[model samples]
Target chain A: MAGETVTLSSLVTWLSRFRDLVTENRNYLTELDSAIGDADHGANMARGMAAVMEKVGASPATTADELFKSVGMTLVTSVGGASGPLYGTFFLRFGMTAGAVSEFDGAALSAALRAGLGGVVARGKPELGDKTMFDAMSPALEAFDASVASGGSPAAAAAAAYDAAVVGRDATTPLVARKGRASYLGERSAGHLDPGATSTAFLFQALAESLAQG
Target chain B: MKKLINSPDHVLADALVGVELAHPELKVDHTNRIIYRGEPTKPGKVALISGGGSGHEPLHGGFVGFGMLDAACAGEVFTSPTPDQMQEATKVADSGAGVLHIVKNYTGDVMNFEMAAEMAEAETGVRVESVVTNDDVAVEDSTWTAGRRGVGVTVLLEKIVGAAAEEGRDLAAVASLARTVNAQGRSMGMALTSCTVPSAGKPTFELPDDMMEMGVGIHGEPGRHRVPLAPAADIAQQLVEPILHDLDFSGAPTIVMLNGMGGTPLIELYLMYGEVAKILQKSGIQVARSLVGNYITSLDMAGCSVTVLRADDELLRLWDAPVNTAGLRWGV
Candidate 1:
């Protein structure tokens, strides 16, 4: 989903699917957060997504870009915590980069996703291996780009991105945090995969799953 | 789970209802989950807004009034408020002068505030400036990380900066003062027991009867370390030493707040404050002003936090200025 479709409908569907995955894993995410964060990442994201679905349910966006922008605004206001803005910025920039395109070639989608990743980096100021969502997202985007360059379809590229996200998420367990609340734990922050990165992996997985449905 | 409540889901909303009913001076925007002063933003005056999770009561909400915040957005217990809520608060609180956002240094709080500022700027053309409070000395400040947690200094910063805004200061002045207040303050907290959020239906963390967690933040997240329970004097040293070590508090007249982390009795807090004061006196630190009680709190965590703000003459003046609000009311 990250590098697959630049259209507004595809983006909306992607966000809707992301919302579902977050809601389902809310408790699991919260459990991980209890180890390193305030124990609200799961609940916060669940509630934020619930709001997103509710807000977008009745009047679905006619365009993929509109849908992404709408979801971005909802997350910014509904998510409340750091995830809201970081994730919201991701989609806001994605929507802006993709503009009003109704559909996109693989290259267009790849560029939009890269642009979104750039937004997350700019806002979170996280570098590689900081045990942030960036850890998962950066690798996933790279995989998507590589897959598309190798002539994979949107669905196959999404699956590749999802695989990269999972690996990145798992990799966070051994890394020390240099950002967010977990960073406060210092060396003690090791031994726990970041709840943010884990949940972000779900975002890519959901995208792949949803695109398969389409 | 045995706590009194209609349902776990209704805790925050029901409590907010209770707040609006009990405090007529405060207005509740249940739709956006914001609690604010009922009065309109004063014309030509900069507006101040602060918010975080709900369990820390009288905070963003209690601090909203004449000499403090014009709006306080409330999120679920111990969760940061959403950006949209902040954006709405900014719009309503803005009086054509500008809006000052006082945010805690939590990742969620910082990001949400940033998004809200961006939204307000794009949609309403409201000039918004924010001061991030990171005065807690428990976490080491380094090149890599969000730095220290923002704790008790938040309460003091709001009051002092709120005064600056009340004086018809511009947004930049208000924001600058807020930042100065944050830089000059340091806080350290400890918890005897982990508090339970109503939704969670259990304590946030476990604590043995013989031990206490030191360097606790307002959230019930575990502290720097857990140590055996000590006497009031020893506990006072344990809390104050980190603060003293983190920053220089000597030679300046300081305002000290010995705050209870909810569920602690005033009797205990006053006793703790006595020990803290004696220790400060021995360390040659002058206490120009002090407040003892639950100013900022973790939900039902039986513990206390210490905050020392190195106040200048101007800050002292603002500290004593008239403030009419539900939480802090002074010279009318």
Candidate 2:
């Protein structure tokens, strides 16, 4: 967290905060999913994050690649829904992009997050208006990279990402979904907050909070 | 919410134990959450594996036996099984003739199976072929979204394809037959009420007392739209017409199933079947074989679905073939 570089500890702390955020909002996420999905989003997120944390806790990972690889694989194996593979691939890609490094400066973080988002897009085949996690995460990464390019500190970049993600999540309310289970609703999908987008917002919020400590 | 279980979180795990105790004919792999026939896949027989969320009893799991699936993975209620579970089943079920994964067309199920197919092949050198069944006519736009939710036709496909696999068809033939069964079937479902997932502990959606949700997916997802509750005959018309319209069922031997959603009684299901049968008769669709009752269901959703598979002699033969399984028992 010193200077602009996020140490391995900070990344783990970020993951821990993300886990806590998902666990706390599990019911809320499920409620959102119930409106448009299977009503398991909350339960799925809670269980998946809990599984990720368990893997993280057991024989703690010393490097970014080792950390998020387990995080991704754990989620992919423990969580059965679309979120499992999508989020799992995100972390797996992030870890792969991060290589064996223990610290990520602002630019490096942007590249890592960008790669994670690319993985999600590749896995889900989602478009911007698809009312998926991509809707939130895509914009958040853009804001993160934009702030970083403007010479913003890591904390400021993360804050920008979090703010953009919230805006992106809220913008989904009026959208008619074109993908996922919600898309099965067609017209009825409009006016409902996408559960995936909501969770993705939480992911960014956790990032911003972790970086705020710096 | 008032489900018979030790706890919400342990519903799947606890139910696996019950599945083991109740069915000695099948073997339950508790750690992997798979249900297999008492014996391993017969050597050289192409194994057929299918699974999905647990609430739909006798489906994937109960169908595992001599002439049906070799193994079935069980996910938490209303959730697709993980890839690792599917991979485990794939590895165990393979006997050098390869394995066929009969996946329901849900996004989660498709993705998980896709991953399992790749992983199983990569890790164990087991060849895996998959057939994703999307027989529900409910989701009108197949080119878009996740397409139709796989429903009752899955039962029909499992029986038909499983028989073919048991007959020692290669993976290519078994997988192709599975696809043919999927293409030839169409289904429509309606729900009188929304079912609650044990962990969610509440109705997934609310339907007014006088209204009914039509075209419902198996998970209690909101269907095409809600309509006023009607008589059994009218409800049958609503369910059967769309299926008939979606495909040409006339002049073909069709397998019809009037499947109940979990909560409806046998008496009501038979009554609904009567109405459904009448419509098919009037429409000139010959029913070569018929199955009624809760073959596939949403837990506690007081409703029914009708699956019509336009079949030929081959499918009918497989359908009639001796099969021994917990959910289905006949010629065997």
Candidate 3:
């Protein structure tokens, strides 16, 4: 399944699942944000993902890259915050990495996820444990890489990535943020999960569910 | 929770509508959420644009007039506007002369404005230069963490740069003045109460009446520390001392502003300013000019900020220059 062909419907389905996950957990995400940020992360992500689902569902693209690119541009335009740019850049870069492919298997998916992580790093500059979205996303990508290299199916690889993301998200609760608005809280930022990381975990969970359903 | 509004959700839209109604001199762009002078963009004058979340009133909006901002983009309450909104504003404000962006150094605001500038330059060849104000001394930036938050000095930078632009100074000169104003000014704020975002329908943070948050940001983000409530004079000292220590205002004539954070009253701001002035006098600093009012604000946050700009003859002259807007009007 090295060069498996994926369809635009798969992309739309994944984003729909992601949006639902965010909507269901909006309160929990906002609570996480309340501890360190302005407490709007959960709501902002939910709104963004809901908009993503609506836009993608309305006019389904044929190619995987085109589908992801639409999601990326929509997020960038509609989100209107730091998360919009960061997350939007992730999808945009991921689509570019996919190179207009119709489908790819576990290894190719891992490469695309790696490319998305790189885009986030380039934009946010968060390190391994900066208590940002990168904390969760970086590890999730690594877990996907490991699982794919070990010949795990895409579903199994996504499940591993989701687990890694949850761990990384919880790790932020003890670590003080060194980036974004939470950094202004200094020592006070501890004892709260980074909002970005929490939402990132949701993204991975959505991916896992989408893979299983597909 | 109490506000003078048709509905909490409609505050920004209503306010923009009211602006158009009350001031026929200003042109309100309902679609893009920008406020500009009624007259078209001046042919050769450098355009000045500043904006952020909607809660910081009189700023970005009230500052748009003959001698202040050419345009102001209004975002949702406590949320920065998108790059598209800012790009549209830049295009509208730019004639043949380049445009200058007076941006607050918040992460979202900076990123959006930078994106707008990039887009504006690419689309229309408008030489867009930006000056970011980061005068808040609450946050420490070591090898770790984002740098200090931009706070009150944004108002001062807009006024000075706007004056320069009104004087028909070239874009380069206006940009230079804007940077100088940013470098010379320092501000610190404290909150007696947290602000409630209209959309959130609750306070951003809760504070007991017995305590106050020192070094509070305009957006209701918690500050450097929380301390027991003190007298207005003492609060003034706490806010001014840090700013004075961070920068040298000695031997330099300073323009001081004791700005009320929305919910704060003018009487309280004046009282705070009196104490701030006494401290500045004791420090052997000369105050050339001073303003005390709710110039920049958070949404109904009961607090005030102290901004001290080291003014030269040039800045002083510009400060004296006429400015006619909804929030501030003098010598017009």
Best by lDDT: 2
Instruction: Show where candidate 2 strays beyond 4 Å.
Output: none
Model 1, span B103-205: residue lDDT tens: 9998888888888899899999999999999998888755576778888999999999888888898988888989899999999889999887665566767
For candidate 2, the TM-score is: 0.99
Considering only chain A, what is the TM-score of each predicted structure?
0.94, 0.98, 0.95
The TM-score obtained by chain A of candidate 3 when compared with the true chain A: 0.95
Best by DockQ: 2
lDDT of 2 at B269: 92
Model 3 chain B: ten consecutive residues of lowest lDDT: B138-147
After superposing candidate 3, which stretches have Cα over 4 Å from the reference? Answer: A1-6, B1-11
lDDT of 2 at B121: 92
By TM-score, the candidates rank as: 2, 3, 1
Task: Report the CA-based lDDT of candidate 3 relative to the real structure.
Answer: 0.83
User: TM-scores for all candidates?
Assistant: 0.94, 0.99, 0.95
Arranged by lDDT with the best first, the candidates are 2, 1, 3
Docking quality tier of model 2? medium
